[model samples]
Target: MAQQQWYKGAVIYQVYPRSFQDSNNDGIGDLKGIINRIDYIKSLGVDAIWISPFFKSPMKDFGYDISDYRDIDPLFGDLNDFDTLIEQAHARDIKIIIDQVLSHTSDQHQWFLDSRENTSNDKADWYVWAEAKQDGSAPNNWLSIFGGPAWQWEPRRGQYYLHNFLTEQPDLNFHNPDVRQAVLDNVEFWLKKGVDGFRLDAINFCYHDAQLRDNPAKPKDKRQGRGFSEDNPYAFQYHYYNNTQPENIEFMRDIRALLNQYPGTVSLGEISSEDSLATMAEYTEGGDKLHMGYSFELLTDDYSSEYIRTTVETLEQRMTEGWPCWAFSNHDVERVASRWSDNGEINPTQCKMLTALLASLRGSVCMYQGEELGLGEADVAFEDLQDPYGITFWPNFKGRDGCRTPMPWDDQHAQYAGFSSHKPWLPVDMAHKAQSVALQDADEHSILNAYREFMAWRKTHTILLEGDIEFIATAEPILAFYRTLGEQKMLCVFNLGATTASMPLPLSVVTEHNELSHHTGSVNQQLLTLPAFGCFYAQC
Candidate 1:
């Protein structure tokens, strides 16, 4: 296998800070709490940990909207705590990749606050602002992902500022050289502090149409949810002019140049565009932009083998040198087990099989916290909802709070699963408690143990990491593929359905075989039987 950067096929574990651990009994997870868990995280065999933003923010978007890119949020702990966390993580051979919100900043940010003061201030043009139309309405018909108009009028500046998300999180003007340089400087600041890489948030939304052209209306039939409910007006537009502009390529080059300065430093852009897959390819193309990019392609409730095959194949065909990171769960969406579970019941064996399947995939893999325990979504009451998105579009859509609940480390009966002394930011479901890390730790056949075993096995196989992937077409339910490198080849088969499935192997090409069932010993045969959610990894 050819040698490349560590992140190329690395397993990145995402830690949603607030839900991970609480150190000071404040009920919110802090840096010290994360530091305390380094050994546990390292035990899982992940190469790196991608932390969700913990920068000072108003929590309007739960740290996605940043007030200070350099400092840690008081709720999460101070800079000293963050420094210790970084030192501990590195000591365990775990790289730290932080979320960088470059496209926008919290309105409380010093730059935005000054910009809002008046049009004459030096920072007035730092954010995207425009004069109100003759009718005293928003400058355009663009709508925010959160709700109404994307443009919010600032009385002090007498101009409408653009915010694709909440109004409090104003969009930065990437067209301005100074703005671009400032964001890059912030990135350098993290690099100086020993960060390995970044997960760029809303990367495709960095720039807009210079002429301020209105986005064309999308056809009613063509309209899909813009990471929001279909009922939200944000789905009405095609969003062509508002984001994913052609100019984004130049900006990515600038960012890549900075990353190139630090050896082993990589970037994974979160492309949130209407054409996310296409944008993903664009962002990572030619190896001069983002090192890798991921879209919401696998984050949805859809759990069909056909959907998975098509998404990967399409990106493979379009992607030249670009790489993609695949994730089934994150802070923004419901847990995959709960989302994909039929009628809300998931078999533990099936969860183990799924973990093996994800680890065997071609691209870099991202595992959300608590996913290894086969944790499902928590049912939160409307009265206790803290997510603005869920609160705004209640009844039809419960926001991301369900998945953002705290990690259960102890037994279902323990208080707060031993997470904190105080109440958590969100309630932990009784059902999820049974799948806590402590419970799984004791069970040899638990999903957490399966994850550990599969990840450890994966690290020994270069073919599973950087190999070329070729799909083995089957009728239905059975998804099979082969990963081939120089002279090594491995076959991976997964049963994506609830029933037992069987498939015939290509015996002509398979001269030798060894199965990694995890639950059982090797099964080297022409015909394979897969129980519900069974996965088989073998060498030929």
Candidate 2:
């Protein structure tokens, strides 16, 4: 067989800097801490690590509001420490993917400072700015995802500046060629540093409507989605004029051109749009665009078999040339173990089953940091909440802090569960302490071990890595699919329900390999009985 792309069948682990591991006795996780755990990361069988932003920031929206793309923030350590980390990771044959937040920057950024100073400054058009209406309201009906109008009144230039997120984060004006060149230069700095790839954060927001037209209102019945509360005004609009502009695709082409100069380097974009699947297809449809793109469809609360299958099938139907990356959980959402399955209330069979299920799918996968350990969502109280979005919605929506808690490493070193000796930036859930790596290391069937086992076993199946997927028409609780390559074919059957499900074995196919793992039910000559959360993997 010809060699497959390195990303195919590869699992990318996301490491949120503040929550992964802490060194220097500071409450925050840093570069040295990641270096210290390189071996641990390698053991999980993930191909690459996607480290979240660690650039210079004012900490308003954490590191997402970058002030300097070239400099490492003091909280995450200096550039030398990052070099050590890159070297260590490379030595282990693990690639490094850094998060690039090119859409916006902190208001403290030097370019924004100069742009806000005067109308005729050299960097005056570096950010999105417009004249206020006669009524002194916002420039248009654009709404910020964080809340309120997207426009922030800037007294410096006596105009309103567009901020899709926190006011401190001002969106860059991609309409200006100079701004686009500057962003490309920032990425080139990392490419020169020997980084393998990048995960572009909110790449679609790089450009917006040049006319500054007001966004149209959405139908009240279809008002809640994209990780926002139904009551949030941001959810009430169609957002046509504010974002998802046609110009974004050309900007992606420019990014692709720059990346082409760096061989072996790839780009992945995170897109959240009205029709994420369509946007994902559009963003990655050609060789001149993103290498792979992932949408928020799989990160939602809908866990039905139909939803999962349709979401994948819909994208597969629309996306002819684009490759996909699937992820169930991330830093911004609740943990999958808790969201998809009952937490401590139920056994971990479901978590292990999901792991195997995701590994057997068609696309590349992204694993959240603590997912291998079967970590559940942390229940952060209102008093300990740090996310501004959470504070705005309050009791109804507690925000992303629940998913951003510190990683638990050991039991003996439980001062903050070995994450940090000092108090962690976010409270470590005592519940997760019982599920630490040290404890799970001794258990053969732990979720962490299951992940390692399945990933290792997955390498033997060439079809699973690079194959076309076809889902068989099955019942509500059971999901069955076949993956086929040139001459290699495998059948993957899963039971995602709580009750036992059964089906007659198809006489046309033969089960050549009995590789079924984590099995609980029986498969006689004629009938296949699947227990709750059971999975069947075999060669046909």
Candidate 3:
């Protein structure tokens, strides 16, 4: 494989900096902490580590609201610390993929500050600003994903500026060529830092409709998914005009052009649109855009054989040329261990099955921190919640804080679970201590060990890495698929239930069973019986 295409079929480990580890005992994870843990990340057998945004920010929406794109925030240490992290991680053959939030910037950003100063400032057209209507309402009916109106009134400009997220985060006006160039310039700044790739956060929201049109309303039943609860007015609309604009295609090409200049670097877009699967397909098509794209389709509460099959098939059908990346948990959603569980419980066997299924799919995969340990979502109380989104929706929607807690390093540590000497920003889940890396390292059957073994095994099978996928017809709780690469074929079957599942197979017996596979299934008389959450892999 070409060095530039290393991302294809690669496994990326996502490290949420604030929660990963703290090196300075300051209660917040820093770049030096990541540098200290390079061996742990490398041991997981991931090709790259996609660190969430640690850029300079006012912390309104955490690091997503970047005030300075090229500089590291003091809370996460200085740029020198980041450089050391890059050097250490690269030494371990691990690529560093940083999160790049391109759609918007913190209201405190110099560009937005200058733009809001006057109508004719040098950066006046940098952000999306519009004049209010005669009634003095918002420019249009577009809504912010966080809640309320998408338009934030700026007294300085005497006009409303569009904010697709928190009001403090003003959307950038990609319609202006200068704004686009400046964004690319910031991206180039990172490229010069020896980074391998970028996880483009909310990349689809870069451009909006120039006409400032109102988004069409959706039926009450359709106002679901994409992490928005029914109570959030942002879900009431189809979100057509506010994002996924046609102009974004050209911007994607520009990003691709810039990336083309740097070989061995790639772009993986995080797309959440009205039709995210279709948008994922569109943004990554023709090899002139994103190298790979992933959406929230699998991060949802729905988990079943049919749901998994259909989601992958739909994307596979629409995405012919570009690659896909799959993730079950991330900084934005609840942990998959709890989200997919029957009664909000964590099952180690089920997690192993999920990893096998995810890694066996057609494309690359993203493993969030703590996922290998089978960590469940933390139940943060209302008072402990730090996310503004959770604070807004309250009881009905507790927001993302449940999933953003600090990582537990040692179970014996009295306070902060060895994540920090001081009280961390968010409380570490106490239940996770038993599943800490130190504890799991000694248990051969632990989820962490299983993940390491499976990843190491997966690297040996090129068929599992670069093969075409075809689903096998199976009943509920049983998902079967065949991965074919040239003349090599591997049949992957999974039992996704909490009980033993039996199904008829076409073959009477499986002659070859790889010892490295985590299989608890048996094939006899053309009947396949799998233990709860068991998986079977064999040459077909």
- Rate residue 86 of model 2 by lDDT: 93
lDDT of 2 at 300: 79
User: Total backbone clashes of model 2?
Assistant: 0
Go through the candidates in order and give each one's C-alpha lDDT.
Answer: 0.86, 0.87, 0.91
* lDDT of each residue in 18-48, candidate 3, tens digit only: 9999999989998888888889999999999
User: Considering only N, C-alpha and C atoms within 3 Å, which residue pairs clash in candidate 1?
Assistant: none
Candidate 3 residues lying further than 4 Å off, grouped into runs, are 508-511
lDDT tens digits by residue: candidate 2, 219-244: 99988586666778898998777778
Residue 280 Cα positional deviation in candidate 1, in Å, after optimal superposition: 1.1
Off by over 4 Å in 2: 1-4, 342-346, 512-516, 519-521
- Model 1, position 113, has a per-residue lDDT of 94
Each prediction's Cα RMSD?
A: 1.8, 1.6, 1.1
For 1-540, candidate 1 gives per-residue lDDT tens digits of: 222488877899999999999999998998888998899999999999999999999899899989999998899999898789889998998999999999999999999999999988899889999999899998888889898989998899888999999989999999999999999999999998888899998899999888988888889998776356778888888999889999999999999999889878889999878888889998898878999998888887678888888888888888868888998888888888888786688677777777777777778988999888888888999998999999998988888899988899889888999788799998878787888889889988788988998888788888888898888888678888999999888888888788878888776544334444443222457777777777777677
Clashes of each: 0, 0, 0
